[model samples]
Target: MRPEALALLAAACWAVAALFSAPASQRLGAIAFSRWRMLFASLILWGIALASGGWRSLDASAFGLLALSGVIGIFIGDTALFACMNRLGPRRSGVLFATHALFSAVFAWFFLGERLWGWALVGSGLLVAGVMLAIVWGRRGDEQHGWEQTRGRLAVGVALGLLAALCQSVATLMLKPLMASGIDAVAGSALRMSMALLAHGLLLSTGWRGARPLAPMRLRDAGLIFGSAAVAMALGMTLILQAMKHGQAGLVAVLSSVTPILILPVLWLVYRRRPAAGAWLGAALAVTGTAFILLR
Candidate 1:
């Protein structure tokens, strides 16, 4: 399959994970949940790397790059995102996070010399607009805490969301050239996850940001966190790295940003209720924009 397809698949995986993670995050606290999830995902990726002999291909420099990317992407970016979600609710946080596509595109253009012009630019704009529309106007289920509840901390939440976007975009751009140079995506993922695990461990140990004492996880919470690790961090991130290997980093980011749009159908199916009309329209616009990018 093409890298674009893989990126979309990653988005689907993320959408599923997001649905499952919210409750666990609420129960465990964002920092605790994120730390556990990263540790779990690191172990999974390490096993895959060992089994596939992906571990043997990395040299010191590649290892360093992958580790740095992991620190930025998983440790910093994901933690900030979880915090943002906790503060602002998923809908508003998601809208801000989607700006990662624009950040990725701009960074890739200036730093990596990857350019998007004409239809690609238009498609990217439309795609971003559609995602923002869906997130802002889409049906709010019971899961999301209402935006009105977050008014007091809206500025902080927005800042954290933008920080998450920046970290994620920079991490992806950092990895693109390495992956293109024949780095093993699985091993690279494992290395990055391991680094992230260490970083989170440090944060927890230092009691940074009032990192609460490790909460006891209920069976359901454990299950949800593990499932999220497997699908979102392990599989989704691997697919994203592979996508960056084969496609423009900006384009991959744009494609992956469709997670919000993709979640509409998932929500409808799971809840047996339809999204608002705006969601349907947003999905159409996003799909049309994606087609332009792909077909152009």
Candidate 2:
């Protein structure tokens, strides 16, 4: 499969995980949810890496870069994202998260000495426009699902969401050079997950109220969180890392940002109602944008 396709696949995994993650995050809280998710993901990724001898690829340099990426991207970004979700819900939070594509593109141009031109640039524009349209106005006027309701302050949620996007983009930028030198995607992800989990552990051990779980974890919620960790953190992130290894950061980020559009069908399935006109229009634009890059 193409690298861009892998990014899209990662987005799909994330979309699936996000659907279940809202409830889990709501119950577990952002910090606790992220910690548990990373722990489970670390176990799964490390198990695979060890079995396949992928762990051998992590030199000290690679380990250090990945550790930093994990701290910023997974530890900070993931926690902030869920915290935003705890307020704005998945749909709105995803819209804010989609800005990572723009951040990645700019970071690539200024820092990585890379450029996005021609149809790829056009596609990026369309994708971002589509994402904005879809998530901002995709729902029906009369339909307000629980996930559509606000839990807390909207401004705070927006700020956290943007912070998560920036952190994620910066973390991805940090890994580009390392990925170019080649590394096992699974091993890299495992290292990142481990580092982030360690960070979360340290934070929790400080007795920080924000890091503590808001409620006791039920067995079913634990299973849900584990399932989300396996798909979103392990599989999705591994695929994204692989894409980043071989693809342009801007293009890959743009392609993966389609998570907002991809979530529409699932929303319809879960909510038993078609998306509003904005969803269809946004989907069309995003699809066309994706095609521009793929066909270029």
**Global lDDT scores for all candidate models:** 0.85, 0.91
lDDT of predicted model 1: 0.85
Which candidate number would show the highest lDDT if scored against the true structure? 2
Off by over 4 Å in 2: none
RMSD of each: 2.2, 0.8
RMSD of candidate 2 to the true fold? 0.8
Tens-digit lDDT track of model 2 for 1-296: 78999999999999999877888899888999899999999999999999999999889767778999999999999999999999988888989999999999998999988898999889889989998899888989997788889987889999999999999899988988888788999999999999999999999999989898999999988899999999999999999899988999888988989998988888888889999999899988999999999999
For model 1, where is the 10-residue window of minimal lDDT?
A: 140-149
In the range 11-62, model 1's lDDT, one tens digit per residue, is 8998888877877886788888998898888889989999999888799988
TM-score of each: 0.93, 0.98
Candidate 1: where are CA atoms >4 Å away? 140-152, 270-272
Candidate No. with top TM-score: 2
Error of 1 at 54 (Å): 0.7
